[model samples]
Target: MPTQPATAALFPGQGCSLEGVKPLVQRECPDLYELCLCLLDADPFERSGDSTRYTQPAIFLASIARWRGLVRRGVRAGAFAGHSLGELSALTAAGVFSEPDGLRLVALRGSLMAQADAGGDGTMMALLKGDMGQARVLAERFGVTVANDNSAGQTVLSGSGEALAASALAAREAGLRAVQLDVTGAFHSPAMRPAVEPFRRAVANVELGVASAPVFSGLTAEPFSNLAVELSEALCAPVRWRETTLALARLGVERFLDIGPDAVLAGLSRRNVPERAVVRAEELDVTA
Candidate 1:
């Protein structure tokens, strides 16, 4: 018998917009659109700029809407893992909480992250073609944290501008490519310590359930059962995306379907697990 194709659904993190998905959400999920309207006070695509306060919830709604569409078409995922803010979207899609409640939690998370960012001048930069161990050494020396371990040679370092600049220069001296990100906060690092406790309370207040599908956590890079414990620590921990993808692949995930606006995770998965297929959910032919 032919091997069954195992798939994992992926959601995009912050900095990705809902512009590409707004129409779909409005057309296919009127309830979700109404909730977004109440939460954001406008249609998701109405706000074009990337504000952390709005970006998280907007992306979460859009990602979930896309996943709902896939489910309607009988697409079944063996596992799911989202990148950063995408994790909330993943949880919502996996039946952990109602959409409205999940949106509220995401809003709180974004606000707390923004507040934590106000404590200092912090940011993130992607270091390309660098060894992870070497990058960790340089990051530690400059007090920056390796925020996102996306792939083998791709790692996102986060901290103050001066710290990032120093690390970038050192990385250049070591023949690595360093590019600054457009985000305002140093997310997934110790810089978000201020937000951790409050977000923990918010998550604790929520009614969570066992995941309908395996949810590969960014914190543990394994199955997640306790959102309060795992996600609270995620506020001050690096996103172990590379390990998550490897774990998914090891569990027979042959395809990763990007259900958010951008194909960012699909692109990242290409670098991490080139042997598997990566596709955007929107690209699927639902009409068939």
Candidate 2:
């Protein structure tokens, strides 16, 4: 028999919202629209623009839809992974939870994070280039925290706006590149602690199950069985995306399928695993 395609499915996080994708989802998946409507009826999207609850559900639907869409077209995946919020979607796709349950949990997560953000006054910044150790040191010096280790040189810093500003200035003075993020709160940092308690409580009600495939944990940079607890830890923990991607690469995963509305993970996978083949769910139909 012909060799099965070496495929790994990846999911994107917050920055995955691309132009025109949401509209496409609304048009193509009527059930998805209805589900979104139901979610709106409960807490409503307008109520939580920056809520982790809202964003998480939104991302999960987008990703799971794309995954189902791809499966409909005969595509197959051998492994699965997601970045930050995308990990929950990955877990669901890996058979950890049903679609409906995952969506509900994501919404709750968004709500908790949003409420936490309302209370904590903080900001996020992306630093490009320079030493990771140096970046961590700088963040500590300012009492800020490293929110994400996205790649070899790309990282996100989180803390009070003043502290973020101070870090940015320091980085600039040191000739390091940094840019402020357009985010409401300091996600993936200690600043998100307020979101943690509610999230833990919300997750306590969830019925989590074992995943079918290897599910990497953003908090541990390793796979774990107790996915619910691991996912809860991820809320206030920085995403070690670079390490996760590198681990996948080490496993000889040459092809990546980003099952989400946008190509955020596809792009990052390309950057992180340059030698591998990275394709987005949206781009599949166009391919021969």
Candidate 3:
């Protein structure tokens, strides 16, 4: 058996992009194009270049492909952590499901989340260095809501754009680092309640198996071998990413690998785990 890595492999969530990835797939692994197309059930490359539905699966395909390529080069992971949608990819890589099932779940997730967006014009903001206690107080004052309790120092607020903007300004005035996120809707907030039932029903229909490695839950900050119900709730739950990272670090994970397109999670991990070594596999140049 291959030796397990001392690090945890991290996968990024929604904001990761797939630009210029199709050409790489076509050039290096022509076989993947047809397989991915079949999974998408449409000509995503020809249609709207960067639709969320297309981007979601595209990121999954690219991330998993990178993982396979790395394994082909003899890299193996011992533990896994994925941000939001990346969790499914991490689960799939850890043998919780086959690629086809992972693709199906991604498709269902994208469609259901799109439906959730139609419920309201809500937005998300990342507030840095703000008092969680005071932020909650501010949210209550403005009728807004706390969406993501990400790290010890970071929390995300969600509400109508006007409301979010107002809250952000207030936070900034109060000396907090606040910035809006570029997302379709206020995900992980009560605003996504409209999508919960359909997404939950869809996930319950899938069969999830046990993972070979420890998969940390961003919602519960605990390890879960069961993927179905927990993953469904993660779609709209406050991502306890900071807690997850700290917990993983406590388990002697001194090295971290971020397997997704962007380095956001890796960067966040660097900030959160300054004592650890972090490697972003996808960001590295691929061998010919």
TM-score of each: 0.92, 0.89, 0.88
The runs of at least 3 residues in candidate 3 whose Cα sits more than 4 Å from the true structure, single-residue gaps closed, are 1-5, 26-51, 282-288
Question: Model 1, residue 85: displacement in angstroms?
Answer: 0.9
Top candidate, metric lDDT: 1
**Candidate 2 displacement at residue 181 in angstroms:** 1.7
Q: Highest TM-score: give the candidate number.
A: 1
Give one digit per residue, the lDDT tens place, for model 3 in 1-288.
855558788887776666666665566445655776786677555542444566677777777777777777767777888888888888888888777778778877876776777756777888898757867977897878777666667888878888888888889888899888877777777776776777767767778777878989887877874456677777777787887888899988878888766677887888778889888885455433
- Would you list the clashing residue pairs of candidate 2? 52-110, 53-109, 53-110, 53-111, 54-110
Candidate 2 wrongly placed segments (more than 4 Å):
42-53, 286-288
Query: Model 1 residue 265 lDDT?
Result: 87
Instruction: Indicate whether candidate 1 or candidate 2 has the larger TM-score.
Output: 1
Mind sharing the TM-score for model 1?
0.92
Evaluation by TM-score, superior candidate among 2 and 3 = 2
lDDT of model 3 at position 209: 74
* Residues forming the 10-long window of minimal summed lDDT in candidate 2: 42-51
Ranking by TM-score: 1, 2, 3
